[model samples]
Each structure stands twice: as structure tokens, then as C-alpha cells.
Target: MPQESSHRVVLMVDENSNPFEMSCAIEVFGLPRPELGRDLYDFRLCAAEPRTRMRDGFFTLSDVADLGAAEEADTLIVPNRPDTDAPRAPHVLDAVRRAHARGARLVGFCSGAFTLAEAGLLHGRPAACHWMWADSFRARFPGVRLDQDVLFVDDGDILTASGSASALDLSLHVVRRDHGAEIANHVSRRLVFAAHRDGGQRQFVERPVPHIRDESLAPVLTWAQERLGEPLTVADLAARARVSQATLHRRFRAQLGTTPLAWLTGERVNLARRFIERGEKRLDVVAARSGLGTAANLRARLRQETGLSPSAYRRRFGPSGGEPVTP
Candidate 1:
């Protein structure tokens, strides 16, 4: 069991702020993980005012820490209110600015981007917001590169999630980046959520009107997972689903916002990474078992995906790894 973390995460709750996003942040960062034998973050929630009404006046919050709590944060989840156009509290924006200037990592969930934009922290940077607010966000803050379709954007010091639920996605991604795939997976499993969905994947994919019965990929995905050690191909997956390769490809794109081959490659990469983190020393063995075929391919893929070679990854995440080096 590791010691409790020193990393502080401060969430800003303001008038009319959405509670759903707040719960998402708390679920991910606030809850202590007894399973891991320690808490992953030193989490706190702060409000600029002594009393505040939440979104649609669903509830009132009080007795939280003062806005000054953000000053001590290593990561600051910014204030988000329902009225995207309404100006944030001047003091709240100032606090955000201070946190940014101090180099604290900032996160904006949904309309929270408006707060960061108001604070001048997102200028000339990529951000993601709910699709409903995309047009307004772009028109008002053209300088901030708003990726209207992505689920989230991880821009090093600043991050943004497109919608309320996607806040969990961004939080899990942060865990993966800060800890590693293994810890992130454990957290996701605890939440009963998918471990990963690439930030670049479309958050809102439009579907054509259905002309035929819709089929699910769950069975086929499970089938493929059990056979990842075998040399798998799109054709093999298509055969398992009893569908044509074109249909398989179409379903993968429409449902997953990715090609079949891309999904398969990602799974293999994750498998290789898991093996290394479990203390596999021989890169060639890890590659073969993960179906990547060779150490050279493992090296190229691991570095491309994780920015770390097999040995470096193991040294940082394997059994003997006392603490993971910050990425």
C-alpha cells in the first residue's frame, strides 16, 4: 500500500454550476481508493461565495472551502455555470487567472471553458465543449481552438471535456497520464466504466437513418479480446461477426468513431503495455504475446503511443516501481 498522495485537486463551484460535473470530478478525484490502500489525490471543493445555487437550482451548496483553496491546487477544476454567456464572478475569474499564472493544471468541463476563456487562460489553445454550445463558444472565443466534436482535449497544463458525462472520460485520461494504464484501468473498473476512449474520437457522431436492424459489437469485441494473442485481422473479426469486412468497418466507424484495424491495434498496444507494467523484461516475449511480432515493432509502437520504451515503462510502473515519475 502506498502513502496518500500530496497532489491537490481543487474544484470551483459557482452559482448555477452543474452538479453532474461536480459529482463526476468528486467520484474520480475525491473518493479514497481503499483498494489501492490510499487516496490518489488531495481533493477539495471551493466556492467563491458562502452560498450558491446549482444548475436549475437543483440544490444549494454552502460550507465549502473559500475560493483561496484554488491557490494551493496542483490542478484546478474551474467554475462552470449554466448561463454560458453570463459573465462569471470577477473574483472567480481572478482566482482562475492566479491558478493559471502559478502553473496549476486547469480543467474545464462543458461551460467551464467559458470561465477559462474569461480568465484568458485558453487563448490560442485547443478546448472541447458540449456540442450544443459549440457555435456560441467559437463565435465568442475565436482565439481558443475549440474542437467542437472531440470528447476532450488534453493540452498539457489545461484540459477540457465536451459534456457532463465526458468529464469522467477526461478524469480517467488524466489518471492514465499521471499514473499509468494499470491504475487508470482499476479506477475505471471501480466506476463500472470503459477504461479508455481516445480524446480524438468524436463525442457526437451523427448517424444516418437506419434502413436495417442495428447490431452490437460487444460479442465480437469480447471474442477478439480472448484471441488477441492470435494474429488477428479485420477479416477475422468480420468472419466472427458473420458480416462482410465493409459492414464491420462501417459499424466500427459509426459506433466507435474508429476503423476496425485502429481499434485492434490499440488493444494490442494496451496488451503489450500491460505486460511490460507487469514486469515482463523481454520485449520480444511481450511483443509476441501481444501479437505485435517483434521487439522493434514493440519499441516503435510503445514509444509512439506512450512516449516511453518498454524498459523505461517497466522501470516506472513495474512491481519494484516505488513511485511513478510524473509524465
Candidate 2:
């Protein structure tokens, strides 16, 4: 049982709904936080039918609330139905539209994007779904700005994660948004999960066993992390990997789906954010230590990635000598 919470999260399940994503929602939103001495949200499950067959009829989920309950949700999670081509239940779609009209936040995990898209909520909106369905989703709804590469897309009121596992990432993100980083860290720790995984991280990739052995980027990544403040460039990374710049680029693309420079900058920005959260006061020192070079660059990167200025972020996420985000 969860503690009483003002925020109500309702999950809508229909035929062929993926059980994994349903569990993801329940884990993130349904559980009690005895450690925190309170609960996070009031969670409920609703279905258009009293008994719904889920995901190839592997299980029958019964005794959940009816679709009308969705109208009461502060946040409504739509079904991640694996059968993407199947038409959505008309009542379910209407419930979703009503929820949206009432300004409820909408969430889609994996193929759940199809439900939202079917409701016509995702038109001209940035959304994400399973990468395998990218081509079909596009053919069905070209108006949607579908970003298949990212783990998730946070388009303000509508949030969508691209795969089953990315559902956890998006849920943790919602926790951070509603509460703060410290509280979110505590929740992640309770679940034994990583506290922060960027929404922009790639989720679509198939790494086959290479016919021939290839060098792993682990060694060079570790090397660059140790020297982030030393003005390292693509050239430096290539030299450290004992490969040419072009070869390094190819490897990074194949392995990480991002260029080396972008990854390095992201690392630096993360470092800077940590320093700020840990009570760093001098902007110049923070910038220099994080290898952002100057306060201007630091400001740009932080704003671009986090949508928050350093001072603003610190005020919200910085320690008050309370619970440190670190374990």
C-alpha cells in the first residue's frame, strides 16, 4: 500500500498491453516510501473492460477501475500495447482526450506512443516510441516529430520513452521533476538503480558480435574522464586510443551513437552540474574544473541541456545539509 498523496497517477490498460511497462509504472509510482516517511503519488490502474487480456493473452488482469477513473489522474499513463497496428478502443481514446483536456500530464512507455498518437494528442508534438516501430509510426502519423534515437522524449505535458527499459529512466525523471534531485536519488537508491540517465541517451542499437575483434572504447573513455580539465580534443582522444581521428569517429558512432566531442562535452556538463550541486560557489572555478573553459560556455551548456541556470539549479537541487544526493 502507498501513503496518501495529492498527486494521482492512473494507468490505463487495454487489450494486448505490455505487462513490463505496466510494472514499470507501478514500481515507480505505486510503491510506498517508508524510508522517506511518506508516499510519492496515489496510483491506480484502470481498464476499459473489467478484465483485460494483456500482451498475447499471457495473463488476464482483472478487478481494476474503469476508464472513467482516468479523468481524475494528475498523471495518466497510456498502455504500451505491443500490437501497434491494432485500433485503439474508442472509449480509451476518449478517456485520454478528456484527460488531456483537463490538463493532465500524459506518459507513454514503448509502444504506448501509439495510443497517444491514436488519440490525436501527438500530432505536431515531439514523441518517442520503440525504434523498431519508427518507420511504421512515421508512415501512420507523419505529423509527429518522432525521435527514435533517444531513450525518451520530454515534450513538456507529454512524455514518451522509446523502449521497455527506458520506461524506468523516464519514471525516475518524472520523480526528479516533481520532487528534486536529492529525493529522486533516494528513490533510485532504494531501487538500486542509476540516479540519472539523460533522456537524450541513445536507445536504438543492435550491437552484433563482430566477425573480427575490435578495440573497446572503455580504456580511452576512462583516460579522457581523468583529464577532462586538460583541454582534450578529438585529436587527443584518437591518439590515446592509438587510432586515427576518422577511425575513432567511426568507433564512437558504432559503439555510442554519438561523436566523441559530444560525449566529452556531455561528460563535462555532468561534472559541472555535480560540482554545483556539491556547493561550488565560484562560477569560474566550476567552469575551469569541469573543462567548460569559461563561465559563458558553462552557462550555455547547462542551459541547453538542463534548461536551468547554475544558480537556479543549485537552489533547487543543492544540498541544504539535508540528504546528500550521493550515497
Candidate 3:
């Protein structure tokens, strides 16, 4: 990993690149955040050519740097590359492979997962790709384990998103990872975007009907989120949903690609994370509010979810002024 003082991110673009995905990366990592008092990332856009028209012929980008520019990047992002089945340009594939060999984080947005797959970076790894291309991707790269359900997959160094919008989710996630939730939330708020989304969320739900009004789980979800401070069981969730426990389980699996308990635990962890970031020094207070029951349970759960202890997490991401935030 590059030193935090000078973290660099390079956007790898090509003739077939989707302009939307390229712009998404720029919005998250390229633009200067004056509110933060310093540039969060050194962002650059690179292509194999000096200048090239995007996938759509009407727009063109000028003075583009070469793929070699990505050699020193802390993170190398490949935006949506149009064709999933076609072989990637040899030079493009080589540059990605070389960068990965040197420990640079690689991000594949949407069909750009194909580029990483073509370069053999995703072999034997769980990856996410646009749902429409999942079958073709599996057929083309049988070595890759593609999960179409999730919005994105962050496997330490190699990150991949399911589709166009998930690119934003992944980008925000990278910001949250490198800096902290505070900075990430700042960027999200500035863009009027949702601050953070768990990568495990479904890219699209397969509802039986067109409208979600009557069958909507919104009310139950709201209830659950509000009561995250209390111990919640699957039975409790079922009662709140006004459905059988089995039905609730089925709905969660079909719609969320996860169990109800898993979702609840994740929410509790999220609550704890926010509490810690806001400078809640008392572990038991944080734990109780987050519904983890006690400090011991909070420590184990936080470590499992975030790989950090309560104290360590607070120290790393706590509020700058040391003034505790009011609930």
C-alpha cells in the first residue's frame, strides 16, 4: 500500500469505456474536497492512447495519460469496458497484471470486471458483475466465482462491482476504507448521496409484482432499524413483519440474499461504528445502544465485522475535537 500522505488513484480508461463509470470514479476520488482541508486522493485518468473518444462517439477526452501512469498508483480503477466476452487488448491486460503484481489495489467497475477476469486477476476469487453479463462471464472465465446478488465484492485488494450504480457504492466504500466514515460521509453528503451501503446488499431484488406497496417490507425494516438498540430475534422480526418466521426467512433470503439475523447483526455493527466514530468512549454505552448486549460481545462482534476493537476503532476514526456527540 502507498503511504497515506500521498495515496494515488488512477482511472484506467479505454475506447470502449463507459463515460458514466469514468465520471463516477472522478466524482468520488478526483474532485478536490476543500471542506476536508486537503486532497483525499491524487487522482488521474489514464488510457492506452493520448486522447480518445469514449464509447459514444460524440464525446472525447484530451491529454489522457498512458497506462504506464498507473504503475505507481495506490489504486488502479478499470471502469465499464463494454464487451464482456471479447479478449482485452494485450497492452491493457498487461498493465493491469503488472500493477497487481506490485500490490496496487485493483477495482473493476461493472463490466470492467471482465477486464480483470481477462487479466486473470480474479481467478479463484469471488467477484461481482452486472447481472445481465453474469452468465457470459461465467462461461468465458470459468475460473472465477461470480456472485450476481451483491452490489460489490471487496476482497482485500481486488474490488469488483455488479453494475453502473454499484460503482458509486464501491467508490464510497473505498473512501470509507482508506480514510474513515467521517470523511466518507462528508463526501457523500456533498454529493447528496447515501453515505454507506454494505457491499453484500443485493444489486436488484426479484419482486413478484411490479409495485412494492402492499407487499413492501419497508415498515418492518423501519421498525427493526429503530429498535436496533434492543435485542432482536428472528421471531421478533417475523412478528413485526406480521408474517410467519419461515416466510420472513424466505423473504430475507430471496430479497436480500442474506438471513434476517445476519442483516440485523450487520445493522447493529453499523450502529456501533457510527457511535465509535462520534467519540463514544464508553464501550458498554456504545454496545447497549448498538444492541450488542454487552462490552464483551461488542468487542467480538466489532472484531468480526471490522477487524478492530472498540477502543482501537474509536482511536482511529473518532471525532477530531474529542467532544462527544449527543444522541
Candidate 4:
């Protein structure tokens, strides 16, 4: 596990802050997990003022910490701010910059990306935001490389989630990074959410409306997911979907926001992660089962995607085979 600390994660709030996203952060970082036998983080809710009214003025946040809390945080999380185009308070921007300058990890959810970009932290760095705000974000901060496809973008100390639900993904990802996949999965189980989700927000954005029936690509995706152990290619997927390869490529880009090969690689990596977590010690077996062809290939792919070797990943997140040590 990474070094544990009584690290403070200050959730910076404002009049435009979304309560739901803040609650998500609190749920992930605030609540104590006895299963781990130690507090993972010290969570604080901070605002421009001690007591601030939330978005829509329907609810008021009372007894919140002041912006000074952000300056002292180890991680500063900015939840969904209501308007991306509106000016942020000078104090808030200053607090965020101070936190970042002091080496605190900066996180933004939804419109909060605008705050990070506005503070100049996202210049030339990859960022993610809700697809609906893509145009506005580009117009406001053209220097920031905005990837509207992924659920979240983790550019080292700077992280951004695409939307409200994706905020949970980002928080869990932080936990996974700091603690391990095991603890993050435990938190996920407690919250009744998948530790990791398939695909990205692009799939949702493409068809925002609920599909009462399966879309054209749904069956093919399901089929591919089930057959990851097999050697699956674009031709195989296209044949399964009964569409031309070119049409299948169009469908994947439209619905999944990635190429077929990229999606396949992601799925294989996910399966490999699961295998490693379950104590699959043989890298060769893991590679063959995940259809990555060989152990060397698996090593390269896992390193590229997760920056961890197979054995290192297993050591961090694999079955403990015993009790967890309390920090």
C-alpha cells in the first residue's frame, strides 16, 4: 500500500456546488471503513464562507470549513459547480492554486474542471468534463486537451471526472491508487457499485435516452465481453454484429467513443485485473486467458494501461490470503 497519512481531503464548495457530488466525495473519503481497521482519509467540507447556501438555494450548507481548509488539504476536490462560464470567486481560485502549488492533488468533478482550467492547472494537460460542456470548455480554455470520451482523466496530481456518477469512479480510482484495488473494491461493495465500469461516458452520451431495446452494438459488445478469452478482432466483431467492418468501426466510435481494438484491449486489461486480483500468479496463464497472446504482451499492456507490472499489481491488490494490516 502507498504511505498512509492522516491526509485531509478538502471538498471545496460554493453557492453553485452540487450537493450530490459532494455527498459522493464524502461517502468515498469521509466514511470510516472498519474492515480496513484504519481511517483512510480525513475529509472536510469547505466553502468560500463558513455557512453557504447550495445550488438552487433549496438547501443551505451549515458549519462548513472556510477556504483556509483547502490550503492545508492533501487533496482538494472541487465538486460540480453550477455554471462553467460564470466567474469563480477570487478567493476560491487562489485557494485552489495554493493547494496545487503545495503539492496537493487537485480533483474536479463535472463543471469543476472549469475551475481547474481557470486556475491554469490544466494548461496543456488532458482533462475530462461532461460532454454537454465540451464546446464551452474548449471556448474558455483552448489550451487544455479535453477528452470527452472517458469517464475521467487522471493526469497524475490533476484529475477530472466527466459527470456526477463518474465522480464516484474518480474517487474510487483515487482510493485504488492510494490503498489498493482490494480496499477500493471493498468500498465499492459497501456502496453497491461496480469497482470499475465498462466503456466510458461516450456510450451514455451517444444515446442519452434510455434504450428500451438493445442498440445495434449492444449484443456485439456483450458477445465480445463474454469471449475475451478468445482471439477477437474487428472482423470477428463485425461478423458477429452482421455489419461491414467500416460500418462496425463507425458504430464503435459513435457508441463506445473508441476504436474496436482499443475497446478490446481495455476489456482484456479489465479481465486481467480481475484474474490478478483473484490470485492468478502465473502471468503466462493470465495472458493466455485474457487473449493477450503471451506473458510479455500482458506485461507491456498492463504497464501501458496501469503502469504496474503483473507481479506488482498482484502484490498490491491480489487476495491477501490472510488478514489486512491496520495502519
Clashing pairs in 2: none
lDDT of 3 by residue, 1-327 (tens): 332348899998887678889989999999886556568899989988877778867587778788878898989997466766667788989999999999999999999899998888899999999999988989988999999989999999999999998899999999888766667777888778867678888888666464745656667877998999987898999998889999988888766667888888877887888888887789899899999989999999989877888887877788876344333
lDDT of 1: 0.88
Per-residue alpha-carbon lDDT of model 2 for 1-327, expressed as tens digits? Answer: 434789999999999898999988899899987766569899999999989998888999999999888989999999878789989988889999999999999999999899999999999999989889999999999999999989899999999999999999999999877766557767777778866667887886545356766578888988998999889999999999999999998888777768899989988887887778778889999999999999999999989977999899888777677444454
The residue pairs in collision within model 3 are: none
Candidate 2: stretches off by over 4 Å: 1-5, 32-41, 179-203, 206-211, 222-231
Q: Clashing residue pairs in candidate 1, if any?
A: none
Listed per model in order, the count of residue pairs whose N, CA or C atoms clash below 3 Å is 0, 0, 0, 0
* lDDT for each residue of candidate 1 in 1-327, tens digit (9 for 90 to 100): 546899999999999999999999999999988667668999999998999899998899999999989999999999887799899989999999999998999999989999999889889999999999999999999999999888999999999999887899999999888877878888888899988888878887657456766577889999998888899999999999999999998888888888899888888888888777767788889999998988999899989888887888887777664433221
By TM-score, who's the top model here? Answer: 1
Better of 1 and 3 by TM-score: 1
Candidate 3 Cα outliers beyond 4 Å, as residue runs: 1-5, 208-212, 219-227, 231-255, 319-327
TM-score for every candidate vs. truth? 0.94, 0.84, 0.85, 0.79
TM-score of 1: 0.94
Cα lDDT listed for each candidate: 0.88, 0.88, 0.84, 0.83
